[model samples]
Target: MKVLIVEDEKPAARRLHRMLEQLELPVEHTVHSVKEAVEHLSNNTPPDLIFLDIQLSDGLSFEIFDHVKVDSAIIFTTAYDEYALKAFKLNSIDYLLKPIDVKELEVAVNQFKASFRESGNPIHNKAQFQPIDLQQIAKLLNEPQNAYKNRFTVKVGEHIKLFATDEIQLFYSENKGTYINLPNGRNYLLDLNLEAVEARLNPKTFFRVSRQAIVHINAITDIISYTNSRLKVKINSFTTFDLVVSRERVKDFRRWIEG
Candidate 1:
C-alpha cells in the first residue's frame, strides 16, 4: 500500500494525502510538477502505485512516462470532466475527478487492492500495469457529431463568406497567433491559438501535429520519416507549407496515424 501522489496544486495534494491516510495506505512520496516528480523518482525508489494529475504547472503529467518506466498502476486525478477524465478506463487506467466523490474514491481504491493484492490462478500471473495505448486512448476522445468547426459567417474583405470544417486545410500559430488556411489557399487570421483549437477539433479528423500545427485529416497526403525521430508531412492542396514534426510530437503523430 505504498503510494506516490503527483499533483501541482498544494491543497489538492494535501487533501489526497489526507484521504490516503484514511485509507491506511502509506504515502511514499508527494511531488508537485513533472520536473520534481522526475527528479524524485530518478534518485530514489519507485512507488507501488501513483495518484497522478494530468495538468501540472510546467507540463502534462504524461511527460513523466517519457522520462521513466512506470511499472506501477496509476489513478489520474483531474478537474477535466471530459477528454482527460475519459483517458482513464481505456488503458485499464483509473481516475478520480476533482472534488472527488467519496464513494467513487472508495470504489477505485477497492478495485486497485483487489487487482494488485492477490494472485487469481495457480499459473503465471501478470502484473496489472497497463500501459497507455493510443488506439485505446483515441476511443476516449469525443467525436465531432456534425463537423469539425461549427457554423460561422465572417466578413471577407467586403462580402460575407461562410465556412465549414471541411473547407479548412489546417490551423497554425503564426506570430504567436492562430489562423485558418482554407483549401482554396487562403489564410484567414484568427484570434484563437493552437491550444484552443485542439480540444475543438474532431479527434478522428484533426491532430495537433506539433506546437504550431493542427493539421487536417485530408491535408495529410503523405508522411515520410525525417531526421531524428521526427516526420515530414506532405499536406495535400496547400498554398505554401513547410511543416516539420518535432521529435517530441512523433509519438502522438504515430498514434494519430495508427488511429
Candidate 2:
C-alpha cells in the first residue's frame, strides 16, 4: 500500500515508519508539521493511506484538509483523548493512541485491508468511508461537559491502592515511568504514561507545565519568571525536581494560570 506519515515528532515518525516497514507496508513519504504536509499533498500525488497525527507543530492536522483535498484513508495517531470522537468523522480507518502498540497497528491495517477488499476502491467511495466534517465535530466537542477520570488504581508493592484525582498534586515523568505526587507528601508509581494521564485528568485543574510534568492548579505554590521567557513552577512540598514550562507553552500556561 502507498502510505504517508504526518507526525511532528521525528522520533515517533521514525518509529512508525519502522513499524510499517516491519509490517511490509510501503511508506511513500513522511512529513512533519502541517505546512510540510500540505505542501507535499498539494504538490505530489496523494498516497493510498495516511497515518496522521492530530496535533502538528504549527496547528491541528485538521487544518490540512481545509487547505487541500484528500482522497486517501487516514489512521489517526493522537495523545489526546478529547479528539477521539471527532477522528472517526473523518476518513479515518482507525484511531491509535500514542506509544503505538504493534498489535493494534496490525489490527488497524487488517481492518483497512478488509474494507479495501469489500469495497474494491474504498477511497473513491464516500459510502465506504465517512466524509471529513471537522467543523461539526469540533462544535460538538466544545459543548461544556467533558468526561474526565476521577480516580486511578496504582500498585503499592503487592497491594493495590486507589488514588483519588483530587489528592494528586502533580504527575511527572522520570526514568521512562510516570509517578504521581500527592498532597499527603507521598509518591506512587503509575502504570499509565504522562500522555495518558494528561488526557484523562480534568484540563481545568491540571496543566501540563512541561513534557516531564503536569501540575495541578492547587499544587502550584508559586510561578516565577524564568530565563528565556519561560516560567518556573513550584509545586507544594515537592523540591527534588525543578520544573520550567517551555517558552512555546508560556502563553497557554499564563492563560491556564489566570483561568
Candidate 3:
C-alpha cells in the first residue's frame, strides 16, 4: 500500500518518512504546505493513505479536504493535545504526537490496515471539522464584530491598559510579528497574529483587507485601487501603510464585504 505525507515542517516530514520506511510500507509521495498538496492530489491518483498535519504554513490541513477527495486512511500528526482530543471526537482512526514514536507509528499503521480490510476504505467519510470550528474560521476570514475588544486586556508597560476593538483602527504584520494600531492615538503590539484575532472577533465591524493586515470598517477614510488587482486602504491608524489585497483573494473579499 502506498502512502502520501503532507506536512509543512521539513524535519518532521523527513522523520515521519523514515519511520514509515522502517514499517516497510511503500511510500507514494510527500509534499509540504496546503497549496502543494492540492496540486499533487488534483493530478495524481489517490494514495493508499495520507499522514496529514493539522497546520500548514499557509492554512489548515482541513482545507485540503475541501479541494480534493481522498478515500485513503489519514493519521493526523500535530503538536497540540487539545486538537488531538478533538480529532478523536471526530472519529479519526489515529493520531501521533510530534517527535513521533516508532511504536505508536507502527500501531497506527496496523490499525489502518485492519480497518481498511474491514471497511474497504479506511476513512469513515473524509474527516469533518465541527461546525463551531468552521464558524470561527469564517469569522476569521472577513469583517469582524467588536465582541473580542473589551474582553482582552493587555499589559503594555508598568500600566495595564485595555483597548477595545473599536479603539483599534488597523492590525498589521511587521517583521512577521503582529501589532495593533489603535484609533485612540497609539500603536501597541498584539499577542496573536491577525489570523487568530480575526477568528475571535465578531464579523460585522472589522475586515481583513489583506493577508497581513485587518482594518476596522469604521477606520477606513478612503479606498484606493492598485494596478495589479490589489486594493489600497487608507485607514485612521498610527501610520500610513500600503494594504495590498492579493489577486486570488480579491473576489472573495469583495463578496464578503457585500454579503
* Count of residue pairs whose backbone atoms collide, per candidate: 0, 0, 8
Q: TM-scores for all candidates? A: 0.48, 0.61, 0.48
Identify the candidate with maximal lDDT.
2
Per residue, candidate 3 scores C-alpha lDDT tens digits across 94-119 of 67765466777898888777877787
For candidate 2, write residues 1-259 as lDDT tens digits: 6889999767678878998888878689999889999999999987878898876777778788788888888888865444445546453446786657778899888777787778854444334444546766545444445347667766565466777788899999888778899987788876556876786788889999889999999888888999999999987778769989999999999999889
How big is the positional error of residue 134 in model 2, measured in Å on the Cα after superposition? 2.6
What overall lDDT goes with each candidate model? 0.68, 0.77, 0.68
Query: Model 1: which residue pairs collide?
Result: none
- Residue-level lDDT of model 1, residues 1-259, one tens digit each, is 5688998766567767887778777688899889998898788776767888876777777778668766666787865434444556545566776545556777887777777667432111124543446444434443444224453333345444556766677888776556788766777754234664565568888877778888877778888988887898877655455778889888888888888
RMSD of each: 14.0, 6.6, 10.7
Q: What's the TM for model 1?
A: 0.48
Q: What are the runs in model 3 whose C-alpha is more than 4 Å off?
A: 90-93, 118-120, 123-259
Candidate 1 ranges with C-alpha deviation above 4 Å: 120-131, 134-259
- The window of 10 residues in a row where model 3 has the poorest summed lDDT is 138-147
